[model samples]
Target: MTYIVAYIASLIVFGALDAIWLTTMTSRIYRPVLGDILLSDLRIAPALAFYLLYPVGLVVFAAMPALRSGSAGTALAHGALFGLIAYATYDLTNYATLRSWTLQITLIDLAYGTAVAGLTALAAYQAARWVAG
Candidate 1:
């Protein structure tokens, strides 16, 4: 039950951050002619990312046997991996929609991805700790 609560709480918090990050970051690169459509869709990214996390969460769960083994760093690493994956997938899908994928542009994209991962991972770690307790 605690685990469930933690996961849910983390998802909400991280989800909001994800949306904020996406809207702000993307706006700098490409202004969507769809107006509010991007914001609406951005909200969905968190849940989408979380869904991806399910498989990774299984790994996290399995590692639970190590109990005292993992740290926030571990979560961050996992989250970073998720972010990179998300970035690649997103970039590929939106390439046509984007203006240009310059080096600076790519770096910015990566920054946003990293931000999402780090923030979410931290939230998840804290929530997990609370839940585990």
Candidate 2:
């Protein structure tokens, strides 16, 4: 329960930071800041919001383990796997949505997934150690 809550809170913080970075730094060809919610014409289902929790949780979980093991090789491999899982979860869940239709969107999602995996893994591992010690 604590892990789940931690995942949710961490994800919200990370996601918002990501949004801010994207909005401020990225091109308009991508998304203008947090414009995804605004620009999408498709209707979002209530159940779909639940999908948010898994990707974030998986990334954090996988990353923490790999990083705590203190092997860069392990971190990279596991992080990539975590990223793939997160991407799959995201893509599969949004199949009905129009955002899932484009090549650019898919690539962008892949990048984000990989980043989340790598970053969360390292951060969670260090954080856990810090808290324990």
Candidate 3:
């Protein structure tokens, strides 16, 4: 039950933040930086999949452990680490394989991912604790 709560909370928090991030960064950062490579439209399936599933990773890797430890700090730390690793992998892979990928994009994405994921996990952990209490 706590785990379920954590998952849903993370989903809501991460989704909301990521939505804002995407909308804000699309034109100001991503589009300008990756001009010609920008897609005409987002592919719904993969986008939906990412939005839906990313929180599960947050819940499992960050929130759950924090809940067990009863420490919100744990949530933030674990989440940030997870986010960094995950984002680093994605960005580094793209930079390596795709000519269009750039250091600016990779750095921006890493920062965003680290901050957002940490915030999401901390929020979810707090939500779960609040509910449980």
Candidate 4:
């Protein structure tokens, strides 16, 4: 039950933050470089899958451990590392395989991912603590 609460909290926090970032930040950053490669219409299925699935990774890797430790710092550090690795897996792979992918985009995304994951995990950890209390 606590795990479920933490998961939901993390998902909500991550989803909200990600939506804001995508709306306000990513387009300006990505569109100039990605141009036509940036789709005019977002494919809903993959986007939905990402939102649903990525939080599961966070819950397992960062939130659970942090909850066990009762330490927000643990959550932030582990979450950041997980984010870096996960985002790198995507951005680096695209940089390597895709003709249009840019090093700039990869680097920016890696940073963004790390920050977002760390903060989201921190939020989740704190929310769980509050809920538990």
lDDT of 1: 0.57
TM-score of 3: 0.95
Q: Rate the local accuracy (lDDT) of all candidates.
A: 0.57, 0.56, 0.91, 0.88
Which segments of model 1 are wrong by more than 4 Å? 32-68, 92-103
- Which residue pairs of candidate 1 clash? none
TM-score for all models, in order of appearance: 0.61, 0.56, 0.95, 0.94
User: Candidates ranked by lDDT, best first?
Assistant: 3, 4, 1, 2
Instruction: Give the top-scoring candidate (lDDT).
Output: 3
What local lDDT score does residue 54 receive in model 3, on the 0 to 100 scale? Answer: 84
Cα deviation of 128, candidate 1, in Å: 1.5
lDDT string, candidate 2, 64-101, tens digits = 56545755455456656777776867655664466525
Q: Considering TM-score, where higher is better, how would the candidates rank from best to worst? A: 3, 4, 1, 2
**Candidate 1: worst-modelled 10 consecutive residues by lDDT:** 58-67
Give one digit per residue, the lDDT tens place, for model 4 in 1-133. 7678778887899999999989987668888887887888899999999988888888789988998998889999989998999999999999999888989889989999999999888877877778888
Better of 2 and 4 by lDDT: 4
Error of 4 at 58 (Å): 0.8
TM-score result, candidate 2: 0.56
List model 1 lDDT by residue over 1-133, tens digit each. Answer: 5455546655676667766765676666555443443444446687687555743452353223222455766666666666766676776556546554445655667677766665566566666666677
Candidate 3 off by > 4 Å: none
**Per-residue alpha-carbon lDDT of candidate 3 for residues 1-133, written as tens digits (9 for 90 to 100):** 8888998998889888988998888899878768888788999999889878888898999998998899999999999998999899999999999888889999999999999999999998998898888
